[model samples]
Target: MKSGVHRKLLNYFLGEDKTMKKFTLSLAFLLLCLSYLPLWAGDYRAAYEKNDFKTAFALAKPLADKGDPEAQHMLSGLYKVGWGVIKDYQLARKWMTKAASQGHKEAQSSLG
Candidate 1:
């Protein structure tokens, strides 16, 4: 009877150990994703305000490529108005269309 109880206790401890390992692994993965997600720029706003549209354009392009509607809209505006970039209406229309197709209201307004 004592040996049977010891076996049950051992199984319970083993189960808890497995559960703890799983929990730790899941937490680590979550941390990794949160730290790395949407890795873009350090200070896009500062770059824009400093008239460093070149850097703003650089930082926003990757986010725009990833389908971020706000980034797409800004990139479209940059292309449309020649804001630190050569005016290119075709590129502007392309990005505006992309944002509008995603249901971005501002992008639709800009396209019109």
Candidate 2:
């Protein structure tokens, strides 16, 4: 009778161990995929397209500050249109010029 109880406990523990391992592996895989997400400047374009201006501005500002020309161009428009931020044409032109200097075609044409 004692041996049967021991066997049951052993099986229970083994089953729990397997479940724990699967959970850990799934969590790890999810984190790995999240870590591999691209940091492209245009990544925030979806937010802008959705008219989620606050989210777009929040995402673009950091990339623009980090010297991303595409982000600079987008940020320029955000400033010009007062989307999720105060209107400031001077700031818009400043950011546009920065993007244009980096060979952003749209910014260059807009500047002209």
Candidate 3:
């Protein structure tokens, strides 16, 4: 009886330890992925600067939808110029307004 109880306790503790290790690894991986977000944003800007509007739109659309002001501003420009999407002043104004509301200076100036 004593040996059985001890074995059960050991197994329980080992299971918990494995769970903790998994959690720690998962957290680390998540942080690593998040750390690359800025690099992706930089890629978007570089694509735009290089006149790779399609790539820039592909990159910025997601971030803009997630409410990144800079991405929203870039998306607005893309919309306004029909660079990567159909020219739609309505959509351009919509994204520009979103960026301006988030205190993007260029967006604000453009709105003015």
Better of 2 and 3 by lDDT: 3
lDDT score for residue 37 of model 2: 69
Q: Which ten residues in a row have the lowest lDDT in candidate 1?
A: 37-46
lDDT score, residue 77, model 2? 97
Expressed as tens digits, the lDDT of each residue in 12-102 for candidate 1 is: 6678556667777899999998887545344555687798888888888887898888778878988998887899999999999999999
Score candidate 3 by lDDT.
Answer: 0.91
Pairing residues by index, what is the TM-score of model 1?
0.62
Off by over 4 Å in 1: 1-33, 36-42
- Top TM-score prediction, candidate number: 3
Mind giving the per-residue lDDT tens digits that candidate 3 earns over 47-108? Answer: 99999999999999999999999999999999999998889999999999999999999999
In angstroms, give how far residue 97 of model 1 lies from its true place. 0.8
Highest lDDT against the true fold, candidate: 3
TM-score per model over all chains: 0.62, 0.66, 0.73
Local accuracy by lDDT, each model: 0.82, 0.89, 0.91
lDDT of 2 by residue, 18-100 (tens): 66677778999998887776644465899999999898999999989988899999999999999989999999999999999
Clashing residue pairs found in predicted model 3: none
Which of the predicted structures, 1 or 2, would earn the higher lDDT when compared with the native?
Answer: 2
Judge candidate 3 at residue 27 and give its lDDT.
100
RMSD each, Å: 5.6, 7.3, 4.2
Off by over 4 Å in 2: 1-35, 39-42
